[model samples]
Structure formats: structure tokens, C-alpha cells
Target chain A: MEIFLQQIINGLVQGSVYALVALGYTMVYGILGLINFAHGEVVMMGAMISLSALTALIGIGLSPLLALPLSLMLAMAGCMALGYGIERIAYRPLRHAPRLAPLITAIGVSIVLQNLAMMIWGRDYHSFPQLFANRAHQIFGAIISDIQLIIVIAALCIMAGLMLLVHRTRLGRAMRAIAENQHAAQLMGVDVNRVISITFMIGSALAAVAGLMVSANYGLAHYYMGFLLGLKAFTAAVLGGIGNLRGAMLGGLLLGLIESLGAGYIGDITGGFMGSQYQDVFAFLVLIAVLVFRPAGLLGERLAERA
Target chain B: MSLRFVGSLLFATLLLAACGKSATDHASNLLTVRIGAAAPLTGPQAHLGKDNENGTRMAIEDANAKGIVIGGKKVHFELVSEDDQADPKTATIVAQKLVDDNVSGVIGHLNSGTTIPAAKIYSDNGIPQISPSATAVAYTHQGFKTAFRVMANDAQQGQALGMYAVKNLGAKKIAVIDDRTAYGQGLADEFIKAATAAGAQIVAHEYTSDKSVDFTAVLTAVKAKQPELLFYGGMDAQGGPMARQIKALALNVKFMMGDGGRTPEFIKLAGDSAQGVYASLPGVPLEKMPGGKDFSRRYEAKFNQPIQLYAPYCYDAVNVMIAAMQKADSADPAKYLPALANISHDGITAKIQFDDKGDLKGGAVTLYQVQQEQWQALETVGAQ
Candidate 1:
């Protein structure tokens, strides 16, 4: 049916965004064994930085062709610096104190980032200026906008690039060595701190891209945009196996599909008692189910081996 | 690294900040009375909140220029503004802060969700509270004697919307969606009842949160129903994006919005998609109001921006409260409370009078349609 196909396209576009953000959480957890709750704020900062930059650039009469990539690169670089600084200043100090200390600090850092963003951007919702030509393409009576198509293709390409980077590069081997065992990796003469910082920078870069995508998709951004998104991405990470790379991707796409389909069909499935408002309920339910059935998650071998 | 150290550090800083705002007696040897205004001075609704504050501020400035004598003394009125952030929890905190500051009266807590919770604090403290924009019917239903509004309630606006949609716009099959907030959901429920009563078929109903920006899933479901029109009960922040998504999905349905959606911000967000959308406002169009033309011109002269919705209502609310004070010859709310309940004042919006429940009497609703990127008044309903 056209309706079903339409929902599928919506899900795929949304799923890629989730997967992009999920990669940040999984990579940090893979290295630091800390959830880095502040990762979401980094995504917010990314959106804010890029949005502000793009608006400023476009306002000064810069063409979209040059302005778009320039703003994106600026956001990625800004987020990378911010990611490195936060880990160095907040997480590094509490690394050895206790497991809960770093966790608490991560939450504190998230709050600090949110308040800081409020101070900078104020609390109004800034609508994303339309930059790209989002022509609609009809497939079998289902419509997919050009922006949606770009999101899917761009996400796939990014994921593939990340896969090649982690498998083929020396940095990837060092990252895996540290995730296997921090002390053991250090004993083996690997620069654990450098790799950890690199991991954070890489993850934050991905978050920046995801932030731009989300703002462009929804056409709105605000100081508080990162909270629910970070939460859902965390759910995706947990569902996929916290430390596993590929699992995060699988979990993100699955969660997005589940949310879209559930929102689309819940009224019919529940005989009209439940409505699309319960769309968020589906994501949380999937989280609980995944934790209950498979504590290790769908691809939980990484967590098991690390333990 | 010590938790106690961090905790104590945070506590000390907060203590100092709280102490700085403690109310102090007027040192100017003049009767300084603070009038409090609470609205979402921050967050997505800040524009509306700022409008309320600006209206209140202008009223205070005008009152000061008049140098009115209250209780046989020249009273200098000061405005105490607080940001509720459009959150209910923050509204209560702002209310308590205003009460602690010993304000003579309160102007607003903008949304119904925030206004209702904040009303209790004002009522308990015997401080009169007037909301310019909160339309939820439950606001006055709680028997809060201190609560009043200058605009029509959702019950009245919803009826006007339902009647206009069916009778004038000729929509028979309608689907309703709301943001699940007090104002949005309550308005949608009322519209559904009135539409059904008018022999219109209610095809499907959907709901989303106030914070959500995406509506594709919900739209897909609603599209299958093939409704002739879709009525949304939510604010502009969500309405703009929802409008765009509706256009993108190419749903062959007309769109209508309630008072919350009838905002300039909504048009900006929806862009080209905002064309042909119908929206309802709870008061007569600004040009049609008794003093609307003069008020709008003067307000823009002072504020340097066009009056968004509710500025005139807020201006009227402040002046009416002051009028009650003048009638009783006292600035004390306890002395003037009775006068406010029974007072009649000609305001910019209407001849202001309240029923026993503090709702506006014979309030009007105006339906407007977006034509070529601007809202044009289509018809006036429920008008005297």
C-alpha cells in the first residue's frame, strides 16, 4: 500500500539520523566505559554552531554552495574541540575516582552545556532556513522528498566510511586495543589518552553531522533539542550492545522503524484506544524489552568479551 | 572530587542568588507598589511572553505618567517580570516569587497549563491574577476567586471554530489533532463535540506532544481517513512544522488551527505552506476592536515592533486591575477584589466585564485565512 511505503520512507530517513547519533554514544562507551551523557549536548552545540554559522554566512550574501560545506566543517571542528575539552576537563579528572563519579560528572556536564546554550542562543525555536532544493519523487504512489533521500544516502556513506576507518587504519587497531583493556593497552605501549581523545573527537564529529541532519530534517532547532534525541540514541545504543559498533547501527535503524510503524499503525492495532501520541512509548518499551530478554543486547559479544 | 565539596559549593551560590531578590521597603519615601507579570519570558513562547510583559510595562508607564493618587498618596507602580518558561512547574515557582515580592496584582502565566497551577498560589495569597491568552476552560472552573481573563475561553472559541468550519467553510469530515497540552487537547475536545453536534462526521483523532516537530506518521494515518479538513489544537512552534509536513506529504485536506496557531511566528515557520490555512483567534480582529487602531499604533510606537496577539488584552488586564484599585480608593487587593469582580471598564479589546466565573462576557471569535503570506480576516463570529 502507498501508506505503508510512505511510512517506510519516513522510517528510513529517521533511522539514519538515530544511527548517526548512536555511533557517538557507542564509540565513547567502547573506549571509556562511561555513558558520556553529555554527548547529547555536544549534538545540540553542533546544531547551534552550524545553524548560527549558516545563518550568518548566508546573511552576508554567501552563496549556498560554499556556505553549506563551510558551516558544516566549522560545526564539526567546533564540536570536536568541545568534545576533547569536555573529556579532558570533566571526565579525565574523575576517571579513576569511582565508576559513579564519572557518570555523575557526565550528567553535570550535560546540564552545564544545556544552560550554556540557553545563555548563548536564548530559548526561542530557530527555524532552519531552506537551503537545499527538496524536490519530491513519487515511487509507487509514495512520496520521498529530496532532503529525505539525501539523508539516507549520506548516512549510508558515512557509516561505510567509518567501517573502513575502524577496520583498515592503525588508529582503529589502537582504539580496539584500548577498548579490550585500557591498562593492558597502555602496557602494550599504546597512547591510551590520545586514542581516547581521538575516539571522542571522532564521535563528536559524527554527532555534529547528525545534528545538522536533524535540524535540516525537522526544519527547527532549539536549546533543548538534544535531550529527547540523546535519550532515544542511548536507547538505540543499549538495544544494539553498548560497546558494539555494528550493533548500534542495527539498533538505531530498528528503533526508528519500530517508532514510525508503531505510530502509524498503533491506532488500528489497539482498536483506536491508543493513538500516535504513544509514539515515544514504543521506543521506551523496546528498550525495556531488549534489556529484559537479552541483557547483553542483540550483538552483545563485545560487552561479554570485555567483561 | 569530593561530592560534599561540590554540593556545598552549589548550595552557597544558590543561597546568595536567592537572598539578593528579597523584597526591600521603598527607600525613595514614595509609595512604591510592584505589579507582577509572569509569562514564558524564555523558551519557544518567549515572543508571546515578552508581548505580555511589554503590555504590562506600557500600562505601568502610562499609569505613572498620569501620577494617579491611590489611598490619598501618589503611588509609583513598578513592574516585576518573571519568566515562567511556559512550564507548569516553573509557573508555580514564579508565582511564589511574585507573591514573596509583595506584588499588588499579577498579569499572567501564559499557557493554561502554567496559569492554572499558578492561580492557586495567587488565590491563596489574595493576589489578583489575570491571564491575557490562556483559553482553557478549567482555569476559572477551579473556583479561584482571584483568577480572571480578558479573552474568551476555549469553550466559546471552539464553538465558533466548529460552527464556522462546517457552516461557512463547509467541512463535513474532519480529523482532529492536538499537542496533548491543556490548551491544545481541551480545545480539540470541545471542537470535536461541537462539530459532531452540528452533524459533521469525526473521522479520526490524533495527538502529539508540544515539543515534537515531526508529523509524518500521524499525517500518514490521517490521510488514509480521507478527511475533508484537519483541525490542529496547538501553538505555532509545532504548527509551522506540521503545516510544512502536511504540504510535503501532499495530503488532500484543508488545515485549520485554533487561537494558539494564529500567530505571526506560525506563518514564518510554515513559509509557503502557510497559504490557505484557516486559524481562529479568541477576540475580534485588532482593527475591529473599540480602541484597536489607536492602541496598535501607539503600542508599535512604544515597542518598535507590531503587536503580536494578546498585547492589547494584557494592556487591558493591567488597566482594569488599576481601575479596580481606583474604584476602591485603595491599592490593597483585599480591599479592591470585590470591585474588580463587578467593575466595568471600556478597554481596547472590548467593554470588559466578567461573569461570576471570571470569564469574559459575550466574547467574540474571529476567523482568519492566510492569503498570499498574510492573515486576512474572513469573518467575525460570536460577536455582539
Candidate 2:
């Protein structure tokens, strides 16, 4: 049905964003074995920084065509720095302490970043400027906006680029070495700490891209926009296998499609008692189901089991 | 040592100054009357709260310029503003703090969820509380003598909106969406009741939370139902984005909402997609009201920001309370209570008079349409 197609498109767009953010979660977990909860805050900062950068450039009489890409680069650079700094200041210090210590520190960092953002931006829903003219192309009665198409393509390209970066380079080998065995990787002359920082940088950059695209797609941004998104991405990471890169992408898209279809059909399936407000429940339900059925996730985690 | 002697002398001087200032403060306190203005001044709704505060502040300034004598004293009205953060728990806390501060009256707690709970606290303390923006019917139905509002309740505005959709807009099949807040759900329920009464079929009823960002799945479902008009019951923050999303999904239908969507901010948020949207504001358009133009001009000149919404009503609420105190010839709540109960005055919004239930008597609902991305008032209904 056209309705199903429409839901699929929506799902794909939403899933791409989740997939991009999930890569951040999965990569950090793969390399550092820490969840990096504050990655969501970094995602929010990406949107905020890009918005301000775009505004500043446009205010100085630059054309939006030139300003848009330039602003995005600024966002990427800013998020990379923030990602590196947060890992250095918050996670790195707690690395050798208990795992619980780093986990709690990630949460603490999330709170601090959220408060800082709130103070800087004030608590308001700002309307993000549309980067491109939005027009919908009808495919068999299913509407796909230009922004949605852009997001899907951008997400795919980024994922492909990340795949190459993880599989075809010396850095990729070093990253895999560290994930496989940190002690052996260090013995093999791989700088484990630097590799870990690079992983954080790569993950943060992906989140920044996701944040910018999602904000543009939604046409709005706020201080708390990233919290639910981060949670959903984390669920996606866990669903696909926390330490697996391709699994994060697969899990993100699957979760997105399921949520969209479920939200569209749940009311009819439940006989009109429930509605789209219950859509969030589907994501959690899938999470719990995955955790029970496949404790190691769909694609098994690649990290070695510690004694 | 010399340093210790100088520190003791400074402490003694400060003690003497404190004692002297206390005596002067006690006298000044008798000459000043504080009116508590509680609203969310720091959160997303800060603009609305600041508008409410500015309206109250402007009224107090005007009263002082007039130099009204109350209880044989030329009272200088001071506004004690508190931020409720639009939370019910915070509302009650601020209400208690205001009561403890011994304010002569209270102006606002913006949302209905906050106003209703805070009203009970004000009523318990025998203080008059007037809400400028809260429109839920349950706010006044609680039988709290202290609770009053300057705007029409949800019942009147929602009925007017629903009837307009059926009668004027010719909406046959309508869909309803609510943000599931006290205000949003209450208005949606009232609109559904009236819309069904007016013979409009509600094809779909969807609910979303206040914090939700995406409405694609919900819109896709509603689009299949093929409604002629889509009515949203929520604040502008949600309504504006919903409008944009509706357009993004290419759901072709007339969009409509209650006063929550009838603001300049809504148009700004929705951008070009806001065109053709219908909304009902719970008062006559500002240009048509007796004192609205003057108040708006003064407000814009003073605040440097256009009145977001409800500032006129807030100005009137403050004036109405002051009017009661003037008629009672006393600033004490106990003395002014009877005067407030029977008081009537022509305010910026309307002839301010309350029915026995403390509801605004015959409050008007004005329907507006976004024409060329601007809110153009179309008709005024149900004034009497």
C-alpha cells in the first residue's frame, strides 16, 4: 500500500539519523568499552554550533549557498574538539578505575554539557534555517522531501566512508588491534591511548553530522533534543551488537523502520485504543526482546571477553 | 590590633545601620503594596511569562502615576515576580512563597495545571488570584473564591472553534490531535464534543506528548483517514512544528487550533506553511478592543518586544485587582475580598466582570486565518 511505502520512507530517514548516532555509541564501546553517554550532548552542540555559525556567516552578508557547507565544517571541527576534550578530561581519567566509575562520569558529563547548553542558548525551541529549498517528490503517493533524501544519501555516504576508515587503513588496523587486545596492541607498538582518542574523534564527528541533518530535517533544535535521540541510538547499538560497526547501521535502520510501521499500524492493530503517543514503547519493547533473545546481539560483539 | 579595632568599628556601624533601616523599612512596607506575579520566566514559555509580568508591571506603573489613595495611604504598588517554570509543583511552591510574603493579590500561574493547584493555595489563604492565560474550565469549577481568569475558558473557545470549523469552514470530516497536557486535552475534548454536536465527523483522534518532535507516523495515519480539517490542541511550540510537519508530509487539509496556536510566535515557527491555518483566540482582536491599541503601543515601546499573547489580559487582571482594592478603600485581602467578588470595570480586554463561578462573563472568541503568513482576524463570535 502507499501508506506502507510512506511509512518505509519515514522509517529510513529516521533510521539513518539513529544509525549515524549509533555509530558513535558503538565505536566508543568497541574501542574504550565505555558507553560515552555524553555523546548525545555533543550531538546537540553540533546543531547549536552549526546554527550559530550559519547565522553569523549570513549576517556578514555571505550567501547561504557558501555559508551552509562552511558552517557544517565549523560544526564538525567544533564537535571533534569537544569529543576529544570530553574523552581526555572525563573518560580518560576514569579509564583504569572501575567500569562503573567511567559510566557514572559519562552521565555526569552529560548533565554538565546540558546545563552549559541551556545557559548559553536559553531554554527555547529555535527554528533552524532550511539549508535547501524543500520540495516533495511523490513516489507512488508517498511524499519524500528533499531534506529526507539528502539525509538518507548523506548517512549512507558517511557510513560507507566510516566503513572504509575502519577496514582499509593503518588506523583501522590499530583500532581493531586495541579492541581485540589492548595489552597485545600496546606490545605490538600500537599507541593505545592515541588510537582510543581517534576513535572518539571519529565517533563524535559522525554524531555531529547526524545532529546537523536531524535538526535540518526537523527544522527545529533545542537543548534537550539529543537525550531521547541518544537513548534510541544506544538501543540501536545494543540491538545490532554494541561493538560492531555494521551492526549499528543495520540496527539503526531496523529500529527506525519498526517504529514507523508500528506507530502507523498500532492503533488499527489495537482496535483504536492506542495511538502514535505509544510509538516510543515499540523501541523499548524491541530492546527488551533483543536483550532476551540474543544477549550478544544480532551481530555478535567482537570485543574479547575479559577474565 | 589596629585591624581588629577597625573591623569591630565597621561591624558596629553596620549593626546601627541595620537597626535604623529596619524602622524605615517597616514604615515603607506600610506604604507599599506587593502583588505577586507568578509565571514561567526561565523556561521555554519565558516569553509568555515575561509578557504577563510586563503587563502587570505596566499597570502598577500607571497606577502609581495616577497616585491612587488606598486606606488613607498613597500606595506604591510593587510587583513580586516569581518563576513557576510552568510546572505544577513549582507553581504551588511559588504560591506559598507569595502568600508568606504577604502580597495583597496575585496575578498569574500561566498554565492551567499550575493555576488550578496554585488557586487552591491562594484560596486557602483568602487571597485573590487572577490568571491571565490559563483557560482550562476546571480552573474555575473548583469553587475556589480566589480563582479568576480574564480570558474565556476552554468550553467557550473550543465550542466556538468547533462550530466555526463546521459552519464557516465547512469541515465535514475532521481529525483531532492533542499534546496530552491538561490544557491541550481539555480543549481537544471540548472541541470534539462541540464538533460532534455540530455534525462534524471526527475521523481520527491522535495524542502526542508535549516533548515530541516528530509527527510523521501520526500524520500518515490521519492522511489515510482523509480529514477535511485537522485540529491541534496544544501550545504554539508544538502547534507550529506540527504545522511544518503536516506540510512536509504533504497532508492537504485545513489546519486549525485553539488560542495556543494563535500567536506571532506560531507563525514564525511554522514559516510559510502557516498560511491558511485557522486559530481561535479567546478575546476580540486587539485592534477592536477599547484599550487594546493603547496598551499594545505602550507595551511595545516599553518592552521592545511585541506582546506575545495575554499581555492585555494580564494588564487588565492587575487593574481589576487594583480596582477592587480602590473600591474597598483597603489594601488588605480580607477587606478587599467582597469588593473583588462584585467588582466590574472596563478593561483592555473587555468589561471585566465574573460570573458566580469566577468565569469571565461572556468572553469573546475571535477566529483568525493566516493570510499571506500573517494572522488576519476574520470574525468575532460568542461575545454575549
The DockQ scores of all candidates, in the order shown, are 0.53, 0.55
Best by DockQ: 2
Q: Over the stretch B300-370, how does candidate 2's per-residue lDDT look in tens digits?
A: 99988788888999899999999999999988888888888888999988998998988899999999999
DockQ of candidate 1 (2 decimals): 0.53
Cα distance off (Å), candidate 2, residue B336: 3.4
In CAPRI terms, model 1 is classed as medium
| Per-model root-mean-square deviation over C-alphas | 5.8, 4.8
| Candidate with best lDDT | 1
Highest TM-score against the true fold, candidate:
1
- Residue A117 shift from truth in candidate 1, angstroms: 3.1
Off by over 4 Å in 2: A96-112, A122-124, A177-193, A241-243, A295-300, A304-307, B1-24, B27-34, B42-46, B57-82, B89-104, B329-334
Those runs of model 1 whose alpha carbons end farther than 4 Å from true positions after fitting are A304-307, B1-29, B291-306
Residue B254, model 2, lDDT: 97
Residue A52, candidate 2: alpha-carbon lDDT: 84
Compose the digit string of candidate 1's lDDT tens values, residues A1-307.
Answer: 9999998888888888888898899888887788989988899999999999999999999998899889999999999999999989999888888899999989999999988998898656677888977789999998999888888999889988887777678988888888788898899999989988888999999899989988887787788888878888888888988878887888889888888898899999999999988999987798888889999778884643321
